[model samples]
Target chain A: MERTPITVSALNAYLKAKFDADRQLGDILLKAEVSNFKRNSSGHLYFSLKDENSQVSAVMFAGPAASLKFRPKDGDRVLVEGSVAIYVPYGQYQVYVRKMTDVGTGDLWLEYERLKQKLEAEGLFRPERKRPLPGFPKAVGVVTSPTGAAVRDVINIIGRRWPLARIIVYPTSVQGTEAKDSIVRAIAKANADARVDVLIVGRGGGSIEDLWPFNEEAVAYAIRDSKLPVVSAVGHETDFTIADFVADLRAPTPSGAAELVVPDRRALLDQLDVLARKLDYVLAKTLSAARDRLSSVASSYVFRTPERLLEKASVRLAHLDERLDLVRPDRLLADRKANLGHAETRLSSRFMAILAAAGYAYGRCAGRLELVNPLSIMTRGYAVIRKDGRIVRSVDELVQDDHLDVRLSDGSADCRVLAVRKGE
Target chain B: MAQEQELKFEEALKRLETLVRELEQGDLPLETAVAKYNEGLALAKRCHDLLKQAEEVVVKIADGETLQDFPKQRE
Candidate 1:
């Protein structure tokens, strides 16, 4: 018996119905590597799921894809749970993925993420714990692949930005299985070096696997334990590592790390120069202010005419006397005559007292001078004989019978030393 | 010796700044102003000397070498 041919749409619909009827097959889990992924503007994800044996078309609709926490990319190993449905239009069966989780990472990354969350909750990522970069570091230690461009970039940038910085490079493996240990050791070494002001640890960009060392707990702990400030510069701008979170400073690139470690040379010089100029300006302003004050004081009336205040009072008194003389002529004249007689008597008495006081002062001063005067002593029958304008105290001071001038209170006389007397 | 020793650069600078502000206020008498001005001059000289002797060093971890110069050393 010949069987009737069914349309492709009808056949596909029948298969879809059967698949949906089976509860187990309706929600099944499939594990495969993603390939040929495509994303459209509508936000739906389309990709082929493949294994060594076969490949299956997979589609994550816009709604479910929007809910996905992680982006699905090509070459990702994932476990997708979905129901297999037949498309009538395409006459094909495809899996409508409900959920997808990374598998190649083998739960390690997931566990790492969970631990990170726990640590973050404990305030390990607190901003307060982050140290400040040194404004002027004497020495910088870099922990990265010595042969890699990361070291070179750091060196070049640091040199250009601050030539005074002394950079020490510690060679370490930045990637692979042993990278974590190498990084830890290098960081430890840098911390131990007393001369190191700061430590910079990082590597160039790569896939997640290539940058796994920075995510290691050991590396993070080393950074946290370091006494010296640590800077993390790992992978690309988008890539972040545990070390970055634990470090004192996080930079997007190796060169950025160098910039964080040292300040800009030109900027520092400019600042110093600015400060110098400010000091000079302040000094000049201060001196000018002082000079202005001095000039103001010098121009004051008191300094210009010291007797001006007294002169004004004297002129006012003279005007008052003239007005009194005109107001009452005889009375003013009589008062003036009486005042003159009283003033004359007072003046004569004051004059006599002053003269007496002056004579006494003069006598005291003259008596004091006379006691020290050689001529006064000669008045007591002791004559002072001088030779060569000097006193002839002894015969040894002059030649025998030398002509001498004798000084007395009355008069000075020229005489000759007739005899000399020795100590008897 | 420590007592006779000069003040640190930052300490002297702070004192000098305070003195300048005081002088600018014009509160001190002429004698006091002159005295403070002399003190400020001494402090300024101290700061200048400290800056003149200022030295900074940058050490590299790779070769463990120190580069010395003014603040903000480059490669």
Candidate 2:
């Protein structure tokens, strides 16, 4: 039997050549659980991959990491598709993963989804609990890592959108076991401070494990209970976490969260301008319409017939005047005065004439009475005498004459005569 | 009385809207329509003035954890 020594360089070169030649070895699929994963400054990933029986080292460069849709972490069961190669410096075989996918979505992912669903069922993701972002937030509170690209993005976006907003940075652990507690405390502090109007809770994009604290139940509960409205901006646009569900609002990125919290001054002004113009148009149209209506009413028949309305009253007044004319006081008084004057004149003249006639008649009557005076009759008296108290004046009386006496004017004679004489 | 108070921009805008509707309905007396038209004109002016006087504001939040006044963009 004989033994021969080999050169280390020759053996290593041969092994490297073999690795380079086998295309199937360079492009194969390996399924294992992730362990001791760390990202370097140059953006290269280093980690261990293990199965139930064997373990191997793996590396994924920044270029491939960037292309990956899902983040990788410790204990993540992954199906990696890459070529097997030897690291010349270490002289050891390792996998350079090009593409990777989770094995059955991994246990961590299942737990994450379960918690997310449970919280959602409890109404934690309800839109009604969401608060409207302020049109112009006076102050803003931030809960994230003190030093990260997320902080820079938010600051830049907010500064660009609204310069007047006062920013309050609350430093917290963003990617470790203690991160959930720290974030919760910061949110509480910001809420307790009356000065904060809104909050932004987020961090830069990273591996799923790196971003796990934001997905924790405690962190989500804290966000749900915050008095100040919160905008979740944890990870990149495609990444969703529990904080997103519980927050008042969800932004695709940290920069987006800043934009949501503060209003765009220029856009607001532009909107106001448009509204002002609309208001003016509405007013002008209204006024013109009113004016037109007013003109129409002014030309209506009621105003035009005013004189006709007065004509009816004038006719009625003339009728009243005619009725009043017949009973005038002056005319009645003049007629009564004329009647009184005529009666007084007629009465005086008639009485005077009657009185004169009566006086004449009375004088005549007195003259007649004077002619029948007794002295006149006595001057014409004749005397005769009768004898022995008897007087006979006719022969017819002589038959019974017993004694007779006669007397002339200067002699005396007595006679007795008894005779009856009848005269018609 | 609330409608008549056009001292504020929002109130003025509301009055203008009401006036427009009234004019569109075509039922107001001529004198009343004229009065409303004059009031609408005044309200429009008030609203325009309010819009013109408004200024904009910007703010910046850092790391989604810190807040700061946004630096004005250099035109």
Q: Which candidate is the best by TM-score?
A: 1
- Per candidate, the number of residue pairs that clash is 27, 38
Candidate 2 lDDT over B3-71, as tens digits, reads 122136445666677876776566666667667767766766666555444234233433344455434
* Residue lDDT tens for model 2, A39-117: 9999899999998888999999998988765667788888999989878777899999998878755566788989999
Model 2 CA deviation exceeding 4 Å by range? A1-77, A80-107, A117-123, A126-136, A159-165, A263-267, A301-309, A324-424, B1-75
Q: For each candidate, what TM-score against the reference?
A: 0.54, 0.52
Summarize candidate 1's per-residue lDDT along A159-205 as a digit string, tens digits: 77765556777779998898899888888878877767788899998
Clashes of 1: 27
- lDDT of candidate 2 vs native? 0.75
Top model number, lDDT = 1
State residue A374's C-alpha deviation in candidate 1, in Å. Answer: 91
Error at A8, model 2, angstroms: 40
- Which regions in candidate 1 have their CA more than 4 angstroms from the true location? A1-74, A79-100, A117-123, A126-128, A304-424, B1-75
True contacts kept of 2: 0.21
Poorest lDDT segment (10 consecutive residues) of candidate 2 chain A: A376-385
